[model samples]
Target chain A: MLVCRDLVKSYRNKTAVSGISLDVEPGKIYALLGPNGSGKTTWMKIVAGLVKPTSGTITYNGEPIGANTKRKIAYMPTEPFFYDYMTIANVGKYYQDFFDDFDPNRFEELIKQMDLNMTDKAKSLSSGLAAKLKIAATLARKAELYLLDEPLNGVDIIARDHVITAILEAANENSSIVLSSHLVDELEKIIDNAVFIKDGSMVLCGEAEKIRAERGKSIVDLYKEIYA
Target chain B: MFKLMKYEFRKQLLSKIVILAMVGILELMFIYGVIAEKANTVASAVGFFMVLAFISIMFVSFECAFTYSKDLKTKQSYMLFLTPNSAYGIVGAKVLTTIAQVFLTGVVFGTVIIANILFMAAKYHSVKEVIEVVQQFFKEAMQLDIQMDLIVSLLVYMLVYWILLIVIAMFAITLTYTFLANAKFKELVSIALFFLILWGVQKIAEFILPDLAHITSYIMLGATGIYLVLTALFYLGTAWMLDKKVSV
Candidate 1:
């Protein structure tokens, strides 16, 4: 479980995340819905401890986010973040070297499932393949919390199924997955919770089914409604 | 910590290989010159090797500094900061890796130069006499005693000074990336800060040891201790800023 209280991140005159507070419970998939510059990535980065919030408190379980929390939280950044020298296999080894929770066998299996060669250079991979590689590397870790920023981005429709399945497999009673994506319909089916963010603030957040029953609209429709 | 150091070394491998490869080729040229008794070729090789030694040492520090700056400026930082490692550990590994590389480079160049001198001494009987004459010339001209203990102490002092220089550069770079990240001229700012930090450390060293003209074992040890303390402060300062302030 993770909790962020009144988080704010400002870059010079612009505010990336503004006074947003939220709790992430265990065993559920959270679909963070937003347009570009909606603070989803920033919030996720803060939770992952990559970005320090301008003024706020963020914690994993009861402890503040640090090296210890990092051990339990696996973050897949939106960008292609692997070293240029890394091959797909090297990326797996890198994760193994850093994270004790990383499972190399699972990484290899996911790499094969994603249809990527072990020796393929990460820098040379197509964007779609790169996304799959990120997913495989992240999901290979049996972390307590997974922060995936736009996991479905650049992934094709057919490959999306594989990605979604891998994501689902990574989520269990002992773990939580917070995923941000623009593909709301694809996510609506799989996500247990939906958090709608706009203009750097949370506009709506609740159980996906409860919101559906009360509002009589799909997550995609809500996305359009809120943003429009 | 060692894992981070390993990756740091890995990141530096290409640069090291290129430098060492050049050194290797030059060594072969020197050997060929010696075998053929070509004075011009031998002199050229020695001169070029000296330049390469200076270039290689400068290149190593700059390369390491640039790597840190690149990590902060680009998405590559996630490859490092995403690990369950603290900023202190990451910075420490980088510093250690730089020292190891400099040490390796020193050893390689030193060994080659010493071996070449010894080889020349064996071949041309006057080479040993030339070394003694050069030592005598330095002692007479500079009034500096060239003893083994003094040479060893000077090497240690130079090593400490180099480490401090690298640490100061890292601190300035980290400051620009973190606290001054939004400034218009962050690169220029870092450059200026680099000099300022160096000057500040120099001033502090002067304060601690007012007279450095006459070098002694105690003076060398004292200077080394001062430099190391300053290095640690800047190193820790950089790591703290990186952990608490840096967004990327």
Candidate 2:
């Protein structure tokens, strides 16, 4: 499980995550629900150790996140992150070199399922293809925690399903996945833990099914109710 | 660190090919002109390559600076920071790659220099005039004889300086992105800071060693040592900044 307490990240005059504490457990799909600039990405980045929290503590399994914890965390950024010179095959090689938990065979299989080729250069791939590749690469790792930032943003309807399926497939009894996205409808059916964040603070959070039954509304309806 | 350097080297692979190809072409042109006894062609080739060499050196230094800064400016950084590599390893690998590129470049140009010297010696049947001018220039500048020890120390000093330039450049870029990250004129501030630091280092060196006219092996070795230490410090500072300040 990943735990963050009193997490706050600020940039200049703006506060991204304002004293927010969150706990995530294994074997469940988490939807970090938020609108654009609602501090979801910043929170995820802090947990991923890509961004340093201005004032707070984030621990993975009772240890502070650092180079060691990075091995267990797979973070997929919203934008294209591979070098321009990298081919899809090279991307796999990079992961193979860096992450000991990386499964090359799984990566090849996932790429095939996503309709991505090994020979395709990362820079030349279309946005949808790139997004698929990111998911494929992230899922290739047998990570304890996966932080995916806005994986469904700007994706098409069909590709959105592929992404959701990839997320589901990436999960296991020993692994937890934290997926941040504003597109709640696509994620509502798959996510078990729903965390609604608004204006850099968590507004609502609970078990998806229990909350739905108690509130008498779907997660998406709750998203609209909370944020809209 | 080795894996990191492998990717860094691969990133520079294309530029290396293009630049080396140009160098080969220029060298061939120069040799052909010499065989044909075409003075104009030989002179033009030398002039062109001189400019190319300067540009290439500048490119390598800039690439060294931008390699880390680009990670901050572009999303490409996620690919790196996401790895389990420490900031020290990431920055160390880059510095090593820069050194390798610079070393290879020196060897290539050194070969050309040797080949040209041999060519001119064979063509003229003597290097008497060239030797005389070189010796005269050294004597006048240093007010001392140019011994083998002096030559070796000078080479070491220059090599140390080359690495220092790259490390300091990376340090400056890291400082800009981390400290003045949100500043509207960060780039401009970075440039100014680079020059200011360069001048400060130079002034300090000049202050410490004011008697360059009485050059000796010990003096040259001391200067090289200073440069080496500075390179290490700058590299460590750059890595520390990346770890502590830069978010991406």
- CA lDDT, candidate 2, residue A129: 88
| TM-scores for all predictions | 0.95, 0.91
For residues A1-228, write the lDDT of model 1, one tens digit per residue: 698899999998799999999999999999999999999999999998889999989888889988889999999999998998999999999999999999999999999999999999999999999999999999999999999999999999999999999999998999999999998988998999999999899999999999999999988998999998
Off by over 4 Å in 2: B115-144, B206-214
lDDT of 2 by residue, B1-248 (tens): 99998888887788889889999999999998988999999999999988988888778756867677777777888888989988899988888888788778867887897788678778877787766766787789889655898889888888788788877778888889888888877667777888887877777677777755366888888778878888889889988988877887
User: In candidate 1, what are the lDDT values of residues B1-248, reduced to their tens digit?
Assistant: 89998999999899989988998888888889989999888999999999999999899877788899888889999999899998899999999999888889888899998888777877778886868976787789999546888788888998889989898989999999887887877778988999998988889888889876568877888999999888889999999999898888
Write model 2 residue lDDT over A152-201, tens digit each, in one string.
76678887877788788889899999888877887888888999888899
User: Each prediction's Cα lDDT score?
Assistant: 0.91, 0.86
Every candidate's DockQ is 0.90, 0.77
lDDT: which candidate is best? 1
Candidate 2 lDDT score at position B28: 93
- Fnat for candidate 2 (0 to 1): 0.75
Q: Is the docking of candidate 1 incorrect, acceptable, medium or high quality?
A: high
